[model samples]
Target: MTGAFDGLKVVVHVFGKVHDAGDGQGMLCRLDLEGLELVATQHRVEAGASPRTVRFPLRTTEISYGGTDDGKLVLKTPEHILYAERDELEPELKRLGLVSLDHVLSRERQLLGGRRRKGLAVWVAVLAGCIALAFGALWLADWAVARAVDLTPAPWEVQLGQAVLDGQTWDEVTDPEVIEPVGKITERLMAEAGEHPYDFRFKVVRDPQVNAFALPGGGVVIYTGLLENADTPEELAGVLGHEVQHVLWRHSLRGLYDRLKWHVLVAMVLGDISGAQELLLAQAAGLMQLSYGRGMEREADRRGVELLVRAKIDPQGLHDFFGKLSEQEGTPESLTLLSTHPSSRERQEYLKELIEENSGARYQPLDVDWEGLQEKLKGGAGIER
Candidate 1:
């Protein structure tokens, strides 16, 4: 979607004067994100005056909804109130990396509002049921969250993930020499992972922590430290397969939805697409900080192993990666990345079981120069290895 909206323009209605140019009243105008201003020619231009233009600094501007059908975007600047149809302005704002008017308003309201609560009777009933059977309510909650994940549209998930990605600052690794091989592994795994809605993207970043995470849609970020730790291309493939499964299964989105279930429920009940986007965007950073439950981790592991086996790549690579992390758990090399994905003995045993289940499958090493690739990355990319 990069550069997809260059020179994009939208029609707006100006409600105030542009300097000395006319009263501006209901003047039809054009606005583009690039120029960060609105301009009008001939609509309200005085005979000798230049085109009526108003500078629109996004940071100071307030965005809300008003006018016919509640589709008009009311952008309030100190000097003027500019209105445009939401349909006309939203895409351009997204292209320019600006939140939509709905999101802007939602965010402001969310900040000013206190936490919402359920009815006391509902809570009492739920609590009584939970007290009757300890895990029953938990199971029901998971079921509801899963259903919510299913109900969430694919495009919205893509937007949520892309918004999260756009909101971050990364020491990204851009060298194709380093990135090309990782891309190949991701592509190979994805081919066997089956058809899906996401247009998967793999990004490598220069971070010392041995970590990799996937956003809700299809954005996966691989830290250089994880690459440094990968003893073989297959190990990297294992990691990529795991992260990809998180997206495919909507684990990140599920986890997020579970944490903010009330907010999400309200948005869904209200049928507010922009409200949902705003909630997710406001919590973008938390996506990285989420730790999956054991069930979710197990599902990702199972699906990732299935991907490897289907691709005829050894599942033992994944098993071995887990084994290594398990051994290093209490050492100085122990990382908080492991805090989210604790490489427990149980997890190792589970991966081993998966590999044994696929023992009859033919296994082959990934076709990559592992040592040479490591050599290429060793002195560069701030590789600690």
Candidate 2:
């Protein structure tokens, strides 16, 4: 994205009569790279009209091209009124850091009558190419981050997970009755699961919101609201298995990766791994609000059902749990981010088909008094550790 534009010229005008200042409709302006300014000259119009030269320093001068800076009209500025007609001048000005990309966007918004949502595609364009990578290496950095993210080590990932937890609120459940059952079930599922590098930790959060989330480093949080909604041991196991599968598949890590802005990702990739961890820690509270992508969510569902089957728990639990959640009117505003996962109805249907297709596999109920335990949990009674 780097180039030399020493003599780039644009023929432009100012409000000499109609808008800004003095004389001509258009004049040739050269972006002087050396002086860090724009200099344009006007020759005598008639016999004795005065010749004029306009200079705007890069620092003090602000540029308004009406739209994104790459190809735009330099219509508004403070010291002089000038317009540049050439397409090549503005990009060079942007490339040289003389013109502010932020200012360019602000002007575009102003011209659109402050319509925020209308020209979003244009916003994405400005953000994607010229703004972030002013020096032109943004794509290389994207490629680098994409490639380097996988090579990040497991311990570092655990630290990233810890960072995730450090930012969010957690109401750790202490009742042995609640705590022990969760552990036992998780152990059963893990026994059934294949090899994994994560040392999983499951915690019951006393939140009344009906949601569960997975974080890097095998961190799983289940809200009490979800437990209260489940009528059977299979229902509990259904959602639990889904979250655990997210950990196994490294979905937590990928979620963090996806939320990162391009420049931020580039910085973290170029900097140390801990810098990335610090970035993750800073954003940990929002991790729950980060929804796993549709494909990732669907994969978790598929793997979740398989884990249930292998563990002798009924695979239908996954289907039943999702089916029930999707039946709700609208997801709560608090749980909006996590609850409204992509294609809920479709996901539930897919889970049902998975169960029906695998019906030949032997299935057995969980050997636990799940209902009695739920009642005890509701009553705020618990077995001690």
Candidate 3:
């Protein structure tokens, strides 16, 4: 049977132990609802079982349960539910705040929803602002780094080359006999190269790898393997001349500047100098992995040929060296050079053509002490040569 209130929707705030007939358990609750109360006359199921349906009627805006001294359930009309005992009803109704229940629930829902929306909007705006600042910071950092540093690969590269050489001096493998000869060759080349803005230095490393490289600080390093392969002084001079051109052009600095520009941009965005430093170090390491571009390689080669011609040395020495290196194209040692500076065949052909055009007529060749250098390199006990 339908009880006192059946069809009305009610917002509830329950308190104390309310039996959930469906769930088969007693629940502590605080229910604030108008026109709804638990049905009293419904058949009581087992003590802990949930009722299929609540059968009581609600006649008032407020109610209280379990208020009787004898444990009998009572329904109060239109406003309140009171049990048969006055002593039981007085304490529970007062504690439940039945007088102001309806007003509190209505105000709570209104204020809570408005505050939630406002807080969500504030968080969204903050997130958007952070994103914009990140991009702006990166842009400013990039601009600043571009203005502050010059990364062109030039004479400074030679300094690094020298440093690498100097570092080798403390090593046990450095042969004292060749030091003087290497020094003499470097001095002569520097004098012939003429004065420029960058401070240049040359190094002869003890490595067997046939390679030479320039650093950003005017340092040029030539490996011993390359030196041993040169049958004539002119061939060695050609290699040195080409490396010197790389230093003069500041190619190392240019590569560094390009990579560092992006790093500085990131640093600016983050407002951290440490990030910039890390980026620079990483870029420096990458510099070793770089090879001169094709145009740059050709320019250096042409310049070197010009230097040898002006120095009264035969340019054929360069072509011969390139020819030897071209033969080892598939080998592991030669792969390093090819990987960085591709077009070995093309370069060799170009050098051969230049040698034909410039030195087809009979010309005197400077005598190079090749046998003595080779003997010295063999680790002989005496320095007779």
Candidate 4:
């Protein structure tokens, strides 16, 4: 009737659950675009029954028509996908002013490709940011730790050392008589140490471990075991000299920094000055138990020998002390000095080389009664100066 579809006869194959078409095969149909319907004039039926007519609604705006690989036209919609002869459908599409199937498909592909490219760029940027953040965290940690150490005030360091010793009583050697000779040696070493900001406190703990350790802010704790082992005042001077240099070089602070770097970075970033101070004070008491790295030990040894030379006490005594420690068995409790100091023949040889380099320098004795001090310690008598 030329009412909806241009009154043209077209052969079509429809697939899907449309209302009345019911998946007709090779049916002759007329399209009705105005009414959005497809009416079949002749469709398959029972052999004895009259030929049936069927109607299916068409949604032209939602239908997608494309050329198939087998030279047929295929149309797809949310409700149905249908096939028709290219010769039958192409003319109708042209008459309706619809673009060719190839143009529509190309536009869809371009739109999809643009979306994929945009998504890929976003993912790449996110990945780059994550990698940069990982490396930045590492670099920032190192730089922040060094800055924290440099910014610490001298008085705070002293207070940190005191906090470590505030509560514990180790029956430490407080007798001035026993302390005087040790103080004399320390004073001689400091005289040549040049100007410094620390008020050095030296203490002798009554423990029997052959070890001595230095605290930040100029606290040096020596065990009686170390004193008992030393055969000469010069050897004791050597050990004190080494410990003194550790304080001067701030090795404890450096070691403490390694432990607290991440916390320091976080605190500095948040500008939490009081939190950082509390952290340092809380954690620093463990400094006495910390072991220095090999590089730090070497630096302390090298600088300590130089100090001994300036004081003109024999530098060979340090070498001899190392030799004695190296001879002792590595018993865990009794030989803590050996364990911590890592005494070796290689270190003794290095010390020998240092002394020989200063062979031309005149050496004098430290005027202390070494034998009498040992006898008192051996006799278990309280020393009186």
> What are the lDDT figures for the candidates, one per model?
0.73, 0.66, 0.58, 0.73
**Cα misplacement distance, residue 350 of candidate 3 (Å):** 2.7
Clashing pairs in 2: 12-83, 13-83, 14-81, 15-19, 15-20, 15-21, 16-21, 16-22
Q: List the residue pairs that clash in candidate 1.
A: none
Best by TM-score: 4
C-alpha root-mean-square deviation, each candidate: 27.0, 16.4, 14.4, 11.6
lDDT of 3 by residue, 1-385 (tens): 1343334434332233334334435433333333344433223467997643333343332333233322423343443332333344334434544444334434544655676688889999998999999888777755756543443233334544444444444222345566556665556567667767777656565666777777766677666777677777777777777777877766665555556666666565566655564555455656666677777788888877776666666778777776777787888667665666564778988877766667644544554465676678766413211
Question: Candidate 2: where are CA atoms >4 Å away?
Answer: 1-145, 166-169, 268-274, 331-343, 382-385
Candidate 1 Cα outliers beyond 4 Å, as residue runs: 1-143, 265-277, 382-385
Tell how far residue 292 is off in model 4, in angstroms: 0.9
Query: How well does each candidate superpose onto the true structure, as a TM-score?
Result: 0.62, 0.60, 0.51, 0.63
Worst 10 residues of 3 by lDDT: 61-70
Positional deviation of residue 368's Cα in model 3 after best superposition, in angstroms:
4.0
Two-way TM-score contest, 1 vs 2, winner: 1
Off by over 4 Å in 3: 1-176, 259-261, 264-282, 360-367, 380-385
Q: How accurate is candidate 4 locally (lDDT)?
A: 0.73
How well is each residue in 115-159 modelled by candidate 2, as lDDT tens digits?
545467778888887766765565665554554467567787777
Q: What is the lDDT of residue 350 in candidate 1?
A: 91
lDDT of 1 by residue, 1-385 (tens): 2244335554443233222223455566656444444443334566788766665666567766666646576777666677676676655565455444446766744543422233456788888887877665556556656667777899989988888888778878776668778877877888897889999988888877888889988999888888888898898898888888999999998888788666666666676646655766677779979999899899999999999999888877888887888788866444756877778888988998888888799977787766766676676843221
